[model samples]
Target: MPSVNPPRGMRDLLPADKARRERVLATIRERYRAHGFDEIETPVMEDYVRLHAGIGGDNEKLSFSVLKRGLDAEAIAAAADDPARLADLGLRYDLTVPLARFYASHRAELPTVFRSIQIAPVWRAERPQKGRYRQFVQCDIDIIGDPSARAEAELLAATLDAVDALGLEGAVVRINDRRLLDWMLGHFGFSADERPGVLITIDKLDKIGVDGVVAELRERGVTPTAVDAFDAFLHRPQTLELRAFGEGSIRKALPEDAPDDVVADLVALGDAVGRARGIPAPYFTLPVQFDPFLVRGMGYYTGTIFELAHPSVDYSLGGGGRYDGMIGRFLGQDVPAVGFSIGFERIVDLLDAEADAAAEAIVLVHDRDLPPADLVSLKAALVAQGTRVRLEQRTKNLKALLERAAADGYTSFATVTAGQTAADLEVKPLS
Candidate 1:
C-alpha cells in the first residue's frame, strides 16, 4: 500500500479545522442574506473558451485545462498538437466570471437588479504559498442591473457590514477609480493606446517600488520627460489627499474635454464609503479611504476598484469593483454590476477559532462481548440528553484508546460490558 496525499495546493481539512472555517463562512452568508442577496452555486468547471476569455487578467494563465476524454489513438494524434482541440473545458479560476455566465444563461429567471451571494471554491494552477493556494474559497456578493453610483455605495455598505461581522481589526479598504487612472495618464501625455499598458505596469506599484516602475515605463518607451513629470506629481506628499480632488497636478492634468462630473462622482463615492465605515456593527471602525495609486489588475473593471488589506499582512485580502460590461459580453446587452469578494481562505488563515468541546464527547463500547443492542441504547440515551456520541470499537488497550480519543478531543467516555445495566456501566473522563 502507498501513502495517500492530496494534490498540490489542495488541502484536507480535519473535522475541527473544517468546523472553524464553516463558522466564518456562515457568518458572512447570513449577513449577505440579510442584505437581500440570494445565494447561488455554479459548477466547478466551465467551458474552456469562457475561462480563457481576456477579462480575468493574469488569471487566464492559471486555469487548469481538462483533457478530451475517451478519444481513439488516431483522433488523439490528430488533435494533440493544438491546445484548442485538446481540451474543451477548464476549472473556474474565480466566481465572478461564472456568475456572469450564469446570469447570461438564466436572465429570465432572475430579477433585473440581481443581488447574489456565492461562497465556493475556485481552482487555479499556481505555486502554493503560505496562505495562497491553487484551490481556495471566495465569498462574493454582487448587484447587477443597477447602473447608479448608488449600486457601488450599497455594495460597499454591505461588504463593510460583512467585514464588521468578521471582527478583524486594522483592516483598511483602499479605493481608486479606473476613470481616475485614465484621467491621470491622459494628463501625463500617454496616448490612449499607451494608457492601458502603462496602467498595467503601474498596477505593480505595491509589488515593485517607484524606481522599478520608472524603469519599466522607460523600458516600455515612455519618454523621460513624461515619466519624470508623472513621478514628480505622484510622489509628492499632497498627492495622497488629491486635495479637493481638483488641485495641483490633478487639476492641470484634467483634459480640457474631460467630463465635468467626474469630480462630483468621486466626492459622492468617497462620502458613501466613509459613511460605510461609520455603520453600526462590531469592528465597524475598519477604514475605507481613497487611494490614487490603487490599480486593480483586472481588465474587466470599468469603474471604481478597491483592495482590502490588513495593516500587518503584505497581500491584499481580495477586492472588486464595477464591471458594468462583463455580463454584457455573455448576454449581448449591457447590464450594470458591482461586487466585492472577501478572501475567505485568507480570512480563515488570519483569524483564530476554537473547537466545540461538547461536540467531541463520545461513547466508547470497550467490550465486543457486549450486545450490540446495548451499545445502540447507550448511544441513543446520550444523544437524547443533547450529547454528541461516537461508539468506539472494543480494544483490550483501554488506556491507549483513552489517550488517543482524548487527544482527538473526546472529553469523556462511557463504557458498557456484557450483561451490565446502564447503572453498572463505568463512565470515565478522557480529558
Candidate 2:
C-alpha cells in the first residue's frame, strides 16, 4: 500500500493550523505595507542555468531540478555524463534570486529604489530534521538601486517592527561587514585564495570555540604563518562587555588597525536605524552588535551582513546581507541590492497560537429530523449578518462533537429547531 502521509519533509496543515498561519502572514503583510514595501511574487521555478549560476553560493547544490519535458530513455541516457543537461529548470531555493530576475524584467515599471516584500514557499532537496524542511516559506524584504546606508537602516527597522508585531520578544540582529572579514583575514596574512576557506572556518567560531577553530585551520593545511597570526589574535586577552553597536564598541571588537572607513559606514548604519526607530541612542534601542567574524555563508554578499538572533533558540531566526553585485549579473548595469529573510518555518513554531477574538464564529447543532431547507435558511441568515456559521448534524456523541467544534475555533454553539429563525436561536459559550 502507498504511504498515507504527506511526502517526506512536506506537510498538510489542518484547517486550524492553516488558519493560524494565515493570521501570522496577514500580520506580516500589514506591517510591511505600512512601511511602504509593496508585496510581489515570482514563479516558483526558474531556468536551470540561472539556479546553477555562481551567485547562489552553496544553495545551488540543493536545488531540485526538473527534467526537460518529453525526454525519453535514450535521450536521458545520453546526458548521463552531464546530468544538469537533462533538466531545463529547477525550483527556486530562495526568493532573492527570483527577485533579482523580476527586477531586471520590470525595471521601467518600478521605482528607482524598490522595496519589495515576498512571502512564499521555496524548495530545496535536503535530509530534513527538526525545524528544517525540504519545502518551507521565506519572508523576505529587499531594497534595490539604493547604495546608501539608509537602505540597510530601513530594512533593519522594518524587520524589527514586523518581529515585534508577531510578539516574538527579545529578538536581536547581529551585524557585520564582508569587507571587514576580508580585511581581517588579510591582516592576519591569509592569502587571497585562502580567504574563503578561512572565512568558512571562522564562521564556526560560535559552534566551536577559539581552540577548535585554530586546530581545524591547522588540520586544513592553511599557511602556518597565517594560522599562527590568527590564532594569536584569537587568544589575546580582553574584557568582554555587553555593549551595543557604535563606533567605540565596534572599534573595541576589531583589531586596532581595522580600516576606519568600514567602521564609519557601520556606525552610520547603526545611527540611521536608531533615528528611524525614534530612539535617543540608536544602539541602546535595539540589540545590534558588531561581530567582526560574522561571515554569512552566501558568496554573493558584497558588504554588510547580519543574522537574526533570539535568546530562546540556538540557531538563527533568519539572516541576509548586501548582494550589491547580484542584480548586475542580470540587468547588465550595477544596482545595489540588500535583503533580510525571516525563517518562517522556524519562527512560526516560536509563537503561541491565539484564537482571533474579533471573529463572530459559531456552530449550529441541528436535529437529524430538521428539514434541509430550514437548516440552510438558518445558516444563510447568520452568515449574511457577518457571522461564520458551521452546520453540524446532531450526533449520539453530541458532547464530543461540540468539544471538537470549540477546539476548531468556534466561540459558541446553538441548538436549532425546525421553526426557529436566526433571532430565535440562543447561543451558549463553548467550555
Candidate 3:
C-alpha cells in the first residue's frame, strides 16, 4: 500500500489545528481591513513566460511550472535541452508578482493610490525543512501608485500594527534603501557592472560574516582595490546601537558620505510612521531600526527595503520593500509600489494554541437511540439562538469524545436523551 502521508513539503491540518489557524488568519484579516487595505485575490497560476520574468530575482528559479497538456513524446524530446519550453504556466512563488499582474490587468478600476491585502498560499519548489515548505501562505499588503516616503511609512505602520494585533510585540523592522546600497558600492570604488555580483556577496554578510564576504569577493576576482577598501571599512571599529528611528540615528549607522537626500527621505519615513502611530515629532520611539546592510534578496526592490525581526529568532519573521519599477514591466508605465509580507508559517509556528471558543459554542452529545432528525433539531434550536452547535453520537469512550469536542473549540457540552427538548438540555462548561 502507498504510504499514508501528505506530500513531502505539504501538510494536513487536523480539525483542531485548522480551527486554530483560521483564528489567527481571521485576526490578521480584521487588522489589515481596519487599516483600510482591501483584500484581493488572483489565480494560483500565471503564464510561464510571465513567471520567468527577470523581476522575480532568485525566486523565479524555484517556481513550480505546470507542464502543458497533450505533449507528445517527440515534443518532449525536442525540448529536452530547454526544459522550460515544456510548460506554459507556473504556480506563483510570491504574492508580489501576482499583484503586479493584477494591477496591470485592472488599473482603471482601482484607486490612484491603491492599498491591497492578499492573504493566500504561494508555492515554490523548495527543499522542505523545519519552518520551510514547498507551499505556504503569505499575508501581504501593498500600496500602488504612490511615490512618496508616505507610501513606505504606511506599509511599515500597518505591518507593525498587524504584528502587534497578533500578540507578537517587540518586533523591530530593519530598514535600508537599494539606492543607498548602490551608491555605497560606487563610493567604495565598485563599478556599476560589478555591483550586482558584489551585492549578492554582500547579502551574505550576516550568514558568512565580513571575512567570508571578502574571501568570496576575492575568489570571484572582484576589483582588488575595492575589496581592500571594503575590507578595511568592514574591520573599522564603530559603536552601533539598536536605536529608535531618527535622522541622527540613520546617518550615524551609515558611512560618513551617505547621500543627504536618502537620509532626509528616511528621516521623513520615520516621522511619517511615527505620526501615523500618534507619536509626535522630535521624539522618536518607534520600533524601527536602520540597518545599512539590510539587503532584501529580491532584485525587484527599487528603493527602501525592510525585514521584520524579533530578538527571539535569528531568522526574519517577514520582509518587503519598495518595488517601484515592477508594475511597469507589465503595464508599460511606471507605477510606484511598496509592500510588506508576513511569513505566515513562521508566525503561526511561534503562536500558542488558540483559546477555546466562547460560551455560545457547544456540542450536543446525543444518546444512540435518539433519532437523527430530533438531534439535528436540538442543535438547530441552539444555533438559532446565535450559538455554534455540533451533534455527536454518544461513543463508548465518553471522556475521549468530550475531550475531542473541547479541543475542537467547543466551550460547553449538553447530554441529549431520546425525547429531550431544547429547554430540557442542560449545558455545562467543559472542564
**Which number leads on TM-score?**
2
Q: Which clashing pairs does model 3 show?
A: none
What candidate 1 gets wrong by more than 4 Å, as runs, is 1-3, 239-260, 273-286, 355-370, 393-431
> Against the correct fold, how does model 2 do in TM-score?
0.96
**Candidate 1 TM-score, C-alpha based:** 0.84
- Give lDDT: candidate 2, residue 83: 60
Ranking by lDDT: 2, 3, 1
Q: How close is candidate 3 to the true structure, as a TM-score?
A: 0.95
Residue 309, model 3: lDDT of 90
After superposition, which runs of candidate 2 have C-alpha atoms over 4 Å from their true positions? 355-358
Which digits, one per residue and each the tens of the lDDT, describe model 2 over residues 1-431? 99999989999998777877888888888898999899999999999999999989889999999999999999999998886889999999999999999999999999999999999999988888999899999999999989988899889988988888998888889999999999988888889999899888998999998999999999989889999999888888888766667888898878778898888999999888777777777356556777788999989999999999999888999999999998899988889999999998888899866624437799999888999999998899999999999999999999999999877778899999879999999999986
- The residue-level lDDT of candidate 2 at 287 comes to 62
lDDT of each: 0.79, 0.90, 0.88
TM-score for all predictions?
0.84, 0.96, 0.95
lDDT tens digits by residue: candidate 1, 1-431: 86598888999997656766777888899888887899999999999999888999989999999987887788879998887788899999999999999999899999978999989999988899789799999999899999888777787777778777877767777777898788878777788888878988898888888888888998999766778877876666543332322223334444345445665565566566655556432223436655667888888999888788887789999899999999999988888899999999887777744333336476666565667897788778777877777788868887887787666566788766765655575777775
Ranking of models by TM-score: 2, 3, 1
lDDT comparison, 1 vs 2, better candidate? 2
